[model samples]
Target: MTTTAHAPLLETSRALITSLQEPGGAYPASPTFSAYRGYCWFRDGAFIADGVSSAGEVASPSAFLDWCAGVVEAHRTPIERVVAAAAGGAPVPQEQMLPTRFTMAGTPGADEWWDFQLDGYGTWLWAAAQHAARHGLDVTRWQPAAGLTVDYLLSSWDRPCYDWWEEHAEQVHVSTLGCIVAGLRAAADSGLVTGTRAEAARAGAEAAMAVIHERGVAGGHLTKWLGTDAVDASLAALIGPLGVIESESELAAATIAAIEDQLCTDDGVYRFRADTFYGGGRWPLLSCFLGLAHARAGNTARAGELLDWAAGTATTDGLLPEQVDGQLLAHEYRTEWIDRWGPVATPLLWSHAMVLRLAAELKEDA
Candidate 1:
């Protein structure tokens, strides 16, 4: 399908995202999904902000970045405490770190959650810097918070935290490390961090890159985490929008091949081989991420095909569900999740954001 064929859905997605943005600049994960309602994840919002920004709707992303900055600033004391502990070799527990998602009011979720992922903070820094650069806006507005994030990440980037899927909390995820490298590079390059901070950011990125290269690759492609040979759809992001790894590099090609051969089908991209969450259905957002990597690698035609597949997942109402169970990996597990958390999250902001992002990239390439 051509970009023209998907124009209506694209327009609806843009409108939906801007409309659902909270007054405080937070983008709720999903407006009506039970487990996701009333909270915003930094990782999800950053990508959403990047998508909205790329789609030529700037205000929503700007507001979201402003909110991100405010949230980080509000936790300055806790951040300093965590940093000091790490510096002193007495690192605090994972729960003591910042949460993975927050209320729209910019506080930690009142409800329990898998709340200690570090990828989101790095993602926010990357997205905020990219937004400022893309729109030619000043970056200083968020510099203080970005610096705080850098400090927080530098302290605990080596620790075992949750992966993007919120599982494997005991292992160092390669995708999470990619996010830190991207964010640190952005902060260092965009002058959002300077002096000793800039040096640290650059050093931190290099250190993370070294670790990724040293232990994150297997069979010439990126792996799920350090010391594993399994591949994940999320790995495509490092070679794409994240821009941590060069898209044109040999390793990028191997990773794309691995994900395509293993996790991707004609329908969509699965998160990982072992994933059974929501019956391990294919995710439209992951498809877009793989599409992005393909586009950046100069495979426009393949990229367009992936974009079309993602668009096909949208509901008749132009809403994209988190994942579709039509071709689930573990079909038997579907109903129990449904009984617990209701149906899969529909009108997921991250899903819409990714579609917007890939659509924009394909249109630009065309």
Candidate 2:
């Protein structure tokens, strides 16, 4: 799992990510994938930014963070309006809120999508802080947008919206809460906000964690959402990359074990047991996420196994797809999506980013 051992693919992933980063600093979800082409997600880009930053590439992630700040600043009016409305007891329609993805030019996408996800905003805050901290970069440049994001999240963190997969828009997802908590904590610690904003960031993060402790945990591990006992592959992220929950803690250990037991297989990890998207194929990114969690928990051997499985999913050309067809959960739905979107998204930036991320973790551990 050392970077030296996987230098070829790791180098290819790094080059591909940097090459695909839009001129505006936006990282397109995928360049050739039909549905994802021309779009960048704050959530995906933040994770990708962290990956790029982790690989010792500063300028790439810095520009992405700058782009994220610019995006929030550009829509300051709408973001404040939504926050004020929610504060006054009348939440605006979901459509009026900020979107989940945007054009590489930093504007909202022209086409409609499950666009109201809150995790991305929080994720941006987290990534910006992490990058600045990792490299000792100045953080003040992002403070204005960070303040706006903290206000927006503090106002509406409890509202139900889309999950990471853009599904179940009606349920408040636990993974989303983890992102918010980590972001808020980062903002509070980053010296990026001051006065009331910083105070609110600390309090908001604590409140979110309280909610998770009271309602998000079930059967000794984190649940998919507040009321459900179901686990999603995403919950593993809370332990490692996000660090909302400590990796060595009992809750983190149990959550990782639950995901491995119920959702993981020899191929990779499934999003959830009932997932049907892309025939519910194993995701290389999710496997890397679980591997990261394991690495943080001091389970290097298991982490290496997960990384190898994910690496095996790469094409001969070293491109990683959004997910693979191995041991699909709902093979029946595969053809329909292929006919609609044409083959799975190859060279998914997030997949390559996750591989870099896990490899970095293992390399450090080694």
Candidate 3:
């Protein structure tokens, strides 16, 4: 049960995330990667904050949450407008919505990128509530921003934007819906919303869960999209920390089994089959996710093994790459991405965060 072997690596991961965190409390996707440089994603930062929170570090995530509050507040007027328009049967253009990522200074990036994803906003709500509850902090501090986020989701939750991979903008991804459900449920339970707002949040969560059950499931497992039978590793989060699917549920079990049988490799897990980004190598973060789901489901031995594989993917300096280049499904396309984006992202904050998270789970269980 001893986790002493991981002590140094875990500490190193913690230090890496802390060191790379921006002065404005944003965790950059990576310090110097060509593709993700200078960007702070709500989805990535939420998971990163959760990892730091689990390690019992409060200030970093608190600052990040405060930054999140500011970002949400800045977009409040637009979000309200969007909601009003939606209610009037005039939905705003997807491009007019708040972006998935922002600069470290808390403004939307001017550069062209995939900006329509709603999952990040939902993820921030969930992560912020989790941090507040875990630390016994006041949720009211971020309530206004959380309200804005909830309203935005309520207006646009049904719209298909982008998946976690930033592809398939035309499909209603199960992972995206799962994130909204988790966030709304967390906000509803945070004691920050009341009366109509609380009722709406709860009702929204129920409706979203209904959609997931009705259309997001296939072959007894959660599908990548509404009509597709494919599985994405991100779906694992739904059964773990996301709680969109109960860890002990039959559906959760089937999803995990499918991921293992199809996407898992010797090094780690791929984002999905046919992933060509960075040659579709095994992702350290997704491995941590599957491990986390296993840990939550009481399969500690399997979780530990996955965690060990993730830890092994780290460089000698203890920095984890976004993915390792083994078991690549698209080796032919590797050179194209490398030529375009330089090397694959090294020390990706999300990867390190997942490693820290899985390590903490093992230590706590031990």
Candidate 4:
């Protein structure tokens, strides 16, 4: 349970994340990867921001939050249109909706991508509220955009969009719903949202939770999607910092046990049983998520074990890769992706962010 040995790695992870962050406040998915090199995803950046904030780097996350606010504000009109369309049960074109990742300049990327995901917007609200509360700052600055985001979620929360892994856009993902619930609850509690907006958001969160309970559960654990029984590593976050599910709840325990049994290896955790991205290598971030869930459940010894395992996956230079090849389920497909997109992303900002997050959790327990 000792974190003394990994103290240096903790500092290194924080520094690496800070160094990779762009001056304009974007945290690139990876600096060298051809595919993710120039983009900043709200899902990734929110976690990264929360990590830095937890590590006592408040300004770093604050800047990122400001950038998010700007991006949301800039797209206010479009967001309203989409919300109105959804409310009226009219079809909204995917191209007209808000995008998932944006350029460093805070504009949507011109390049083609799976850009219909709503989880990131929700995640950003939750993370921003967490930051503001932790640092005793005014949440009002983010309220305008946050309100738009809430409206969007209120209208479209039940729609099928992309999941955290940016795949399966046609299915309603439980984890995606969890993110919306968490975000809505956070926004409602921020003291900035008022009147009908506040009431609607709170009711929306409760309705989302009811849906998750009725359809997202399978055999006591949260399923990957509403109709299926498969579990995903991302579900661990529901019981962790996201607080969609209580860390001590029976459902949370079952979900964690499922992840450990089905997706986790001695090296790290996989996205899912059928994942083939980057040869389905064990993901460093998911390991940190599982560690965080364990830490929240008061399993400090187990949590420390996961943190140590994640630290060991770092390269010799202390850079954490997005995923490791150990126990790769799709080993046959590794070379294909490498040839197509170059080597796997090293020093992935999200991976380092999760490392910092878990390390901070362990340190707090220490």
The positional error of residue 47 in candidate 3, measured at the CA in angstroms, is 0.3
RMSD of 3: 1.4
Q: Any idea what lDDT model 3 has?
A: 0.89
RMSD of 1: 1.5
- Per-residue CA lDDT of model 1 for 1-366, tens digit only, reads 344768888888999999999999999999999999999999999999999998887789999999999999999999999999999999999889999999999999888888789999899999988888888988988889989999999999999999888898999999999999999999999988999999999999999999999999999999999999999899999999999889999999999999999998784899998888888999999999999999999998898889899989988899999998877888888888999999999989999999899988887422
* Cα lDDT tens digits for candidate 2, 5-84: 67788888999999989888999999999999999999999999999889888999999999999999999999889988
* Candidate 4 Cα misplacement greater than 4 A, ranges: 1-3, 364-366
lDDT (Cα, tens digit) per residue for candidate 3, span 256-300: 999998899773899999899978999989999999899899998
Instruction: Score each candidate by Cα lDDT.
Output: 0.92, 0.92, 0.89, 0.88
Output the lDDT of residue 270, model 2. Answer: 95
Query: Which is superior by lDDT, 2 or 4?
Result: 2
Q: Could you tell me every candidate's TM-score relative to the true structure?
A: 0.98, 0.98, 0.98, 0.97
Error of 1 at 270 (Å): 0.3
Instruction: Output the TM-score of candidate 2.
Output: 0.98
Q: How many backbone overlaps does candidate 2 show? A: 0
Q: By the TM-score metric, which is better: model 1 or model 4?
A: 1
Once fitted onto the true fold, the runs of candidate 3 whose alpha carbons sit more than 4 angstroms away are 364-366
